[model samples]
Target: MRRLLGRRDFRTIFIALTVSMLAESVLVLALGVWVKDLTGSDGLAGATFLALSAPMLVAPLAGWVVDRIPRRAIFVALNVVTAGLLLPLLTVRHAADLWIVYTVAVGYGLSYIVLGATVSALVPELVPADLLPDANSALQTVKQALRLLGPLIGAGLFSLLGGAKLALACAVCFLVAGVMGTLLRSGRQAVRMPTTSDRPTWSSEVSAGLRHLVREPALRTVAVCSALSMIGLGVGESLYFAYVDQGLGRDAAFLGILVSAQGVGGVAGGVASALVVRRLGEVGAVAVGIGLFALGSLALVQPALWLALPASVLIGMGLPVSMVGTNTLLQRRTPAHLLGRAATALDALVSGPQALAIGLGAVLVGVVDYRLLFGAIGVAMAFVGGTLWFARRVAQPAVSTEPAPAQADFPG
Candidate 1:
């Protein structure tokens, strides 16, 4: 970990990403809260997240753009542009100006996809393969840690000052992140240019990432298991509210305590993720993460506060461990030119279904018993974890035929 952080480029990227994500964490909750305050409508407030996530439907396009640009340049540009985009929110004083908030939310979503793809592609250039897990872990840890404080800070600021002031603060964070991005001394490789005869069709170009994900055995396992796990996650998203209100006999405020507990666990998980990957291998680490998440789900079935708190912690711990393994594996296996596409492809596969499941769970929670739902989610996640563990035994190692980039050191 120390050695990985010693690299100047990686350190710079780390700080930049941390600052950027802090802004993201702060703004996301504030956006929803601001909308709720403006309209006094829960449905409209909920729509804020929909606006933020809707751009994911265009992730393929975003990924294609990421691949076409110099990643470092795009990373810096996106931060500056995102800061400018947030300035519109300052004008959102009335319900009539709600469009500004939603528009900016869409911009936020697009920036997230582009920046995420850029970073996934850029990180390999900044770190050695042997240190990839550590680098990813460090980044994930800081991001997770911010979840514990960023929202609280944003909420407090919004309450003390105003939504416009909060927006300005978040914009400043992005600008600072852009400054950090300028300090990156590496990841400046030339973009890949296809020859006329070898040029891909638009459809093929867009689907390239998905095709590669299906073709690669390790990535395939990770994608499949991760998608399966998302089913549980999506269902849990809606059902958790019910679990707290009815199952635990608690008010909505208590939900914050559970989330805080999860954040603490997430911090610990991020800190330990590199070691988990080192000992278990990427596939094994993901399996364990999913399994732990399943255990957390099962604990929720008991409805006791004691079980719920610990369960939230376990659930929190599982996500970072699995994500670190997934990111490290993707970086190690993907070709430089395809990294952006591959990363977005995986994001779409996992997040799309999770979004749908949130809707489905919202419907099901109304008609079905919460305990039955929790149990089913846990069992399904456990099955997915077990499937990955078994599949790892026979999975073939990744062997890319594409020539390596001259500047980047991608591991086989």
Candidate 2:
């Protein structure tokens, strides 16, 4: 752990990523509050998520551009531009105008989409291939931990100074991230940049990514499981509030506890995954991780908050494990030239289908009881896990490639 923390490159990006996450968290919590204030409806606040969901639909296109371009330049520009883009809110009141919010959402979500791809693709270049899982676990530990904190901070900030303040804070985080990207340098292109012309067709560029995905069985399996997980996430988002409020009758404080528990669990999970990666290699680690987390979703079943402790921890452990695995796989298999593109596609799968899943989940919330929804999604994820687990056995994929130093001897 100490060795991992000492990495300059990872540390810099980690700070930048954490700051950015903090900003986004504030923006989201603030947005929900603003939307609620505007519409006087909790449902409308939920719809604010729809704004976040929109850009995800085009996540593939974003990924294609990410793949072809100099990822560093693109990411830096995006973050810097986002900082400035958010400046308009410093004075605006009457934020209820749906149009203004919608516009902001589009830009915000789009920037996030590309920035995420850049970060994911950049990781392998920053650290050794063998260190990928350790690096990933460390990174995720930062992201998940900060996310849990971001929402609460957002709410507190909103209480003190409202939307403009929240936006300003977010802008600052983006600005800082941009600065980090601009100042930092990579050693050498571990992978070469793919050749492209000034007049390339968008459809063709996207097709390259799609084809790459289609060709790689490992990538396909990973994508399938990831997509399903996103769907499950969408459903959770749509119904979790109600489940907490209406089903379990938990208070805001209790809800916070559950959320915090999830993060804490995730952090522990990340730590454990580092050890697991040391043993299982990257692919096997992820296979185990996803299954564990997929199985972890069982937390939704236990109604009592006390039951949530172990449930959330088990579920959290699965997340970083799966995420680190998938990301490491992509980093190892993908050429530097297409790393951004492939990563972008992965980003799209993470965010795009998730948006749809959230929408479907939202719709389902209106139609079914919360328990039924939880049970149904849980079963669905379990099925997805079974399919993936079996695929791993059949594919008989080669021994895990270590993303970290000690990872080479997997299944040890």
Candidate 3:
């Protein structure tokens, strides 16, 4: 961890990523609260998440774009463009302007996909392959830590100022992130520069990520499980507002407490992730994470503050554990050239179902009991964990064809 922090480029990229994620976290929470305040409907609040996540369905194309350009340029340009796009949200004043908010959410989601792929592709260039797990964990830790403050600040700001002001503030944060990204200094030799000659057609480029993901057994298994886990996540997203309003008898600002509690779990999970991976291997760790998350969601079925608070913490811990393990697995198995597309492929798979699930849950929340919704989510995640366990018996270790450079301290 100390050695990874010593690298200048890693530090720059980490700071940029942290700042951008902090702002994004705040913006997402704020948007949810804003929509709920305007409409007083759980379904509408969930719709905001649906719009934010729906663009992930196009992540393969976004991934191809990430690979096609110089990553540093992609990183800088995305933040700058996202900031400009968010500026239009300042004019959103009434229910009629909600369409603009949803539009911006889609744009935000698309940029997130592209920038996320760029980050994955850029990490190997910035740090030694051996340090990948620790580096990835550190980034997750920082992002999670910010959750403690981001949600509280966002909710408070939204209450104090309006949504328009919050949107402007989030836009400024993106501008700062863009400036920070430009400070990163990865050498051309370290980065796999995309060539124009013999470039595949657009469709081929889009499918390239999917084919590569399908070819790797471990990667494929993890991607499937993660997608399943995301369905459970969507259930929670739709019902969270109702849970806070009815279960906890609180206003939007109280989301800060739940988010901060989750951050506590995230910190522990991030710190313990490498050790977990070392002991259980990536596949086993993912199963454990899914199980833990399922247990946490089941806990949420109880409406008491004591149970819900701890449940949030459990959820926080479980999610990061799953994500870190899966991410390390992908980085370890994927070739350098395919990293961007592979990351996006996984993104699309995981987030696509989640987006749809959010919409479904949103509708369900209006008609069904929130407790029943949570129970169904918990059962689904447990089933996925069981499926992974059963499949583990039949799954063979993938043959290692990685170049020698990637073999060093690879976490596979």
Candidate 4:
């Protein structure tokens, strides 16, 4: 971990991402709470996630753009633009202005896809292959750790001040992060121009990431399993608001506390991720995370605060552990030129289901018992995790080979 920090470029990127993520974490909870307060509808509040994730359906375009531009430039531009984009939230004065909130959510989603693809592509250029796990772990750890304070600070500011003030604070964080982007000295790549013969058709360019994932055994396995787990996760996204209000008998702000608990668990998971990856391999680590998340989900069925807090912790822990494993595997396996598209393709695969599920959960939370949803989520995740674990063991040899297309770039 110290080794990654010791590098000037990694340090700059790390700090930039940290500042940016702090802004996101602050907004994540506050946005839902703000919408809920305005409309008094759990469905609308949950739909904010739908708004945010809806842009992921266009991830291929975002990926193409990321790959075309210099990643560092894209990184800087995205933060600056996102800061400006968020300013419209200042205009959302009443329920009639909910459009402003949803619009901003869509903008946030677009920026998230572009910026995430840019960062995923840039990281491998900045670090050694062997340190990918540690680097990813460090990044994940800090992002999760900030949830502990970011949500609290967001909640406090929202309750004491207002959502507009909270929005302004987040904009400042993004601006500061953009400034930090200028400090990065590595992971800058020249614009990629395809040779005439190799010029990609629109469909080919857009689908490149998905094609790569399909061709790689391990990547495909992990991605499919991860997407399956998101089914429950998406359901939980909406259900949690109801859980806080009806089940736990708390107000909207209390949702921040549950998120903060998850952050605590995320911190521990991030710290331990590299160790888990080393012991279990990336696939095995992902399986472990899914199983842990399943346990956490099942625990939520009882609806007690005592159970909820620990369940949030387990959910938090599982996220980083699984994410670190997934990301490291992607970075290690993919070629540099394709990283942008591949990352976004993976995002589309996972987030698409999650976004859909959020909508379903929003509706389901009203008619169905939240406990039933939680139990179903837990069981589904447990089954996916077990399937992934079994597949990893049986398909060990096949997983070792790189995709056929990747070989040209990585010729021995």
Candidate 5:
């Protein structure tokens, strides 16, 4: 991990990523607060999140843009575009201007897709193959760290400066991140778009990532189950606040306690991810992480704050571990050229379902009991774990028949 961080390119990208993610965390919380204040409706506030996530459905198409453009350009463009889009928030003094928030949320969502694909494609170019796991682990740790502080910082700033000023602050963060991204050392050429007259149409281009994802057996299984996990995440996203307020008879402030506990777990899991992947292999580690997450979800059915706190820790740990394992697996399995598309495809698969699930959860939470929803989410996660485990067992014979890579074996 130390060696991975010592490399100049990786270090630069990591610093830029950390700044951008922290800004995103602040922006997300402030946007929610902004929407809630304007409309005084939980449903509308939640709808803001939906707008932010809904553009993930377009990720495959965005992947084409990522691959077609130079990665550094995309990275810089994302921050600049976001900064520009967010400037309109200063004009939003009345409820009539709420559309600007949703519009910007969609832009934010699209920016996530573009940035996610660009970064995934750039990592291999910036670091050695052997260091991929450690690099991903370090990045995950940064994200977890932000989870602990970003919301609190954003909420505090919103209280002090009001939403318009808070939006300006986040926009400044993006501008700084864009400048930092410009300092990254240029590497390989991004995948070029075919200009042949017979080139594939737009729809075919959009589906390219999905096709690649489905063709790789290991990636296919991980992508499918990860999509399931995202669905569970969507359910939790809508219900968790209500669970804290209504189910536990606590104020909304208690949600931060759960988030903090989860951040603690995420940090621990991210620090341990490389070791876990080395011991379990990517597939086995993912299965274990999924099971752990399921166990945590099941525990959420408990009404006690103490129980919920620990359960959130389990959830936080499980998600990042599984994510790192899956990401490493994708990187190892995919060719260098297709990395951008594959990453975006995975994003499209996972985030699209998650977005839909978030919408469904919003509606369902109004009708269903929070405990029952938690139970259902737990069951879905367990099902995903079982499915992956079963697939692994069945594919054992075929695994040996598959040709091994020319490089040294992974430390499984």
Candidate 6:
């Protein structure tokens, strides 16, 4: 813990990212609520979120840029673009046109990937090697906290002034994020240039990341676990607002409470994840994390909304636990130059399934009850955990505290 506190640059980056995320979380909720008010249709609001998720398929090109291009520029430019998008959003006088809201959300989805991959990839460059697990845990915990709090604030503000004002607030938040992102500018030189994975064609590059990932036994297992989790959790959360409103028969405040509770859980998990890794070994900790996620997801099956709080918390913690463990393994296994490509590869796997899950969730919510949906999520999670266990005993693990001589070290 003390070692984690010592990484000043990582801490700075963490603070910048956390504040940005907090504001973003609030703004997003506020924007959706405003859209609902304007259109007088929950369906349009749903459309907006779907639009946001729709861009996942197009993300590899963006991921390619993230890897090849400079980190600072990606972070800075994406922030500026986001801020610019939000500025026009402030003028959304009438959300009556579903298309308009959809367009804005599309902008959000496109810009979202830039910051996500950039920030995560950049952190390893800033922190000490040994402290990465702790740093990752520390960073994720803070973002989780912001995610919890952002909505309540957004909802509260929305209650006060309504539409244009909400847009302005969200715009200002983006502007703030842009400014904060600039403060963490370690510049392009901070990240070492990665090796060429392919002949630089977009499709070929995508394939390279995929091929490299497939060749590694450990990363493949991690991918399966994370992707399945996304399917279940993604499906559940996609319809969560409606679920809370209908299933739990709760009011808005109760919904906000559950969201915050999840954030609290995320922070708890992030803070503890490193310790879990340190004590449990990467495999043990990750398995436990996935198990928790599956169980927490099952909580959505509960009749009482309050009862789902622990489940939300469990979901929150599980995210960082699995992420940190998986990422750390990748760093240790992949060569320094291939790390970015390797990450982009993993992102595609995670994102593609989630994109599909979002559409699936949209369709499923119409027929299946939230309880049954959560049950399906739990079953999917079991598949993931089962795969991991089977893979562990048979295949070679990609990572270890001590490097193995049989496998290549740092795939240069």
Scored by lDDT, the top model is 1
lDDT of 6 by residue, 1-412 (tens): 5545544555456666766676677766766787788878788766667777677766666666666776766776777677778666655776455556678788887777667767656665565456667877777777677676777777887899775676666666667666766765353533444357733665776566567678876767777777877777677777787667887787756776777777887888888888887776555566667877788877777767566778778887787787777766665556443555677678878868877887788888888886788888877786676667555542244343222112112222
Each prediction's Cα RMSD? 3.0, 4.6, 4.8, 5.2, 4.5, 5.9
Q: RMSD (Cα, Å) of candidate 2?
A: 4.6
Residue 183's lDDT within candidate 4 is 86
Tell me the TM-score of model 4.
0.84
TM-score of each: 0.95, 0.84, 0.81, 0.84, 0.86, 0.80
Q: Report the lDDT tens digits of candidate 1 across residue range 347-382.
A: 999999988999899999999999999999999999
Q: What clash count does candidate 4 reach? A: 0
Estimate, for each residue in 1-412, the C-alpha lDDT of model 4 and write its tens digit: 7666777777888999999998898898889899999999999998997788788778999988887888889999899999999999988889999999999999998998898899888887777776678888998888878867876777888998799988998999899999899887765677767899989898898888889999988899999999989878888989998889889898999988888788899999999998888788788889989998999999999989889989999999999999998887887777777788999999889878877888899999999999999999999999999988887663344222122121112222
Candidate 6, residue 203: the lDDT equals 72
What is candidate 5's lDDT per residue for 124-229, written digit by digit as tens? Answer: 6677666777888898888888888888888898999999998888888888888888887754464656779878887877777778789888889989898898
TM-score of 6: 0.80
Q: Which sequence of candidate numbers ranks them by lDDT, best first?
A: 1, 4, 5, 3, 2, 6
Tell me the lDDT of candidate 5.
Answer: 0.81
Model 6: lDDT to the true structure:
0.69
Better of 4 and 5 by TM-score: 5
Model 6 ranges with Cα > 4 A deviation: 96-100, 180-187, 190-202, 235-260, 297-309, 336-341, 358-380, 389-412
